[model samples]
Target: MRGSNSSLSSLSRRQPWKLINIADLPDAVLIEVVCRLSCSKLIFRCKCVCKRWLTLISDPYFVDHYLRHQSDKKRHIIRTLIYAREYVVRLRFHPWTNPTVVATYNDLMLCYGNLNRYCICNPCTMQWVALPRIPTYTVHRRSEVRVGFICDTPCYNYKEDEHEDQKGDVMQHNAAYRCKVVRIRPPEKGYYHFSFEWKVDIFSSETGEWRKAVVLSPRAITLNGLGFPHQGILYWLGREENGCSIIFGLDPFSDKPKCFFIALDEPLNDLRHFGVCGGCIRMCGLDMATRSLIVFYLKTEEDGKLCLSKRMVYSLDQNMYLDNESNVSLRPFDPNDEDVCYIYVYGECVRYKYNFRTRKWSTIVEEIPHQISYSFVHVQPWWPTPVPRLPQRACPAESN
Candidate 1:
């Protein structure tokens, strides 16, 4: 028995241990395994494993599955992207000339460049598609124009190929095939006097075409700034002919598409900022008379009517903006935390962060170039969204 045991031990020691190679696994299994990895590991580590891994990671189908899986695990984390003069250093790729982020939805960013140029980008994967040139709209030069971006589908648990066999233009029913860019142009020079409808031009990725539409307003209103999307709806801050402030919303994906407006208690102020926070639309404005910051949340009642409800008020130092020549504007609020806010002192070229929980303001960034405006969009960082494919090959984004 001792002689037999010794012989077995010797045999086991001499034999090489069998190892399992992850790359040898089936594609489906491989996807299932890699989808669980963190975005950093998957992008920086697994993608470097081999050509197959890089290809799999870049696949749209795989990206969709990974996003759904992450959503199921509730692993998404909001990241604020500040695209200032130094943004070029952080973003490795730069395809557009003088690109500025105009809008963001989920993980996609819509960047606008000089001469009516626009492009959609997935910054994490360094993928971007230059959209077709936007056509000129015949509106008054003084009319304010607003642009927005949105996805027709939900952000999670959605399969791009679910309705592949639906026997028609699959793009119509498949949410994955729809991404829209909307341009709101004010009424022509003399048209606003008789009509409340504003001319709207919509560009759809599936059709690669721009279509004309109109949104009716309760009264003639002027869009204040670039709008932001929340819950698949784009909302803009606007002022009416009577000087009353209003929130204009457009539901382009609804079965019956329509535009609606909500009245605000106060008139539109240059220092007012609008954004989405804590899964709700919130607005922060500097109350110059009171030397305080007032926050408002958009709430819907049982009757289905929407209204702004006062959420909080924070007193500001009287001396902070005593310089009458200073242009003090409330910066875009952080989407993740309702208590954290930013204020930009344009004249001083400084941005300060105020924490309502702590009631303190600290300098976040200073000495910003006056020419470089603060235009940014929020995205979920851990989820690396792939760029939507177009019929034409997308141009590669290059780094400076």
Candidate 2:
């Protein structure tokens, strides 16, 4: 028996090893392999390999799995809307580079301000639809219009996946259709005095109609900053008549929508920015006189009311050379990372990033470009959002 085992081992060593074919792997294993691939390779090369692969890659379930995998691996990238030339060329869609992107949600961009142009487009799918002009408001500099966008669809659950065939199949989203765009305009001033009301024009993708709503505030509010969407609610940063900073939040999906105000912490500085960071609404401000950065996080109480709490304060590193005269302001917050923050110094034309974990500051970019849009859109290439096609309506001018 020992001699036979030795002979078998010798024969095994002499024989060449056989390679395992990826096609022979199980569906779960194959999914894991595909999820690890880069977005470009998965979209361009993997999809073209076979019909099964094409169907798998395009399945909504697989997309969700891929996104989770990416997040687990901490793989994310920041990109500008203007830098989508390769995607535009590959998809054969005409690029619209002139309009400035006002809001980005679920990888879709709401671009405004190119000869009064407004549209929503998905860069990955290369699909776009032009929205009708604002009902009655004329474009002007001092108008201070705030725009917010939301595009949410229910994801496939694990229970639903268990019933599918061994070979993966695309799951249909039967009850998932929610997309909205809102334009918040300050109250129209009367000839004699100011009105303490605001006008909100809401556009629904289901109906393709622009409905107007009135938002009332106790004190006069000025919508000065960008509109950020968090947890199905859109928030606008503004100040009151007494120069106290406050946040106004509205739920577009509510049956009876009303603006809810959440007052910020005291001693608020003028140079502050709010955005979704660490899965919450975070606002950061820079104190010019003290060279200190204050960070505040929005939280919810048991009573279902929103409130802001001061998290921590970080003093600006002396090596940064930030002086009292420096025109400094908080830049757009990075949504994927909670440890990193960006601040823009207008006087020096440079952008710096601060690490909260280490409490260190470093320069990210020097000599900021004038043409670039500061409101950047974060996109995950592997997960492409489809732009819904709605019934086309003529522009107001055309109807006239």
Q: Clashing residue pairs in candidate 2, if any?
A: none
Using lDDT, give the best candidate's number.
1
User: What lDDT does model 1 reach?
Assistant: 0.66
- Model 1: per-residue Cα lDDT over 1-400, one tens digit each: 9999998899889995778888679999998988877764445467888899889876767766665666567785866646566455534586555676767777778876656767777666676777766666633232256788988665444323557564322111133547888888765654234347778777777666667886788777767666676666777777777765677888777544578678775643553455655556777766666667777788655543457765677887655664653377776666677677777676666778898779998886544334544456556655555556655432333211
Model 2: how far residue 335 lies from native, Å: 4.5
Instruction: Please list the residue runs of candidate 1 whose C-alpha ends up more than 4 Å from where it truly belongs after superposition.
Output: 1-13, 16-37, 44-78, 84-96, 113-115, 136-144, 158-177, 186-195, 254-257, 300-305, 323-327, 345-351, 358-373, 389-400
In candidate 2, where is summed lDDT lowest over 10 consecutive residues? 82-91
Which residue pairs in candidate 1 collide?
94-398
The lDDT for every candidate, in the order shown, is 0.66, 0.64
lDDT of 2 by residue, 1-400 (tens): 9999999999889995789998888878888888878773446468878988888877766776776666567766554433222233432353455555677775677766445656777666556776776665645442366788876554232333455454343334322457788887655552122346877888877777678788787666676666777667777777666666777787787665667788663446653455555556677766656778877887756554577654677997666654654566666555566677677677667788888889888888544443333455556443565665555553323210
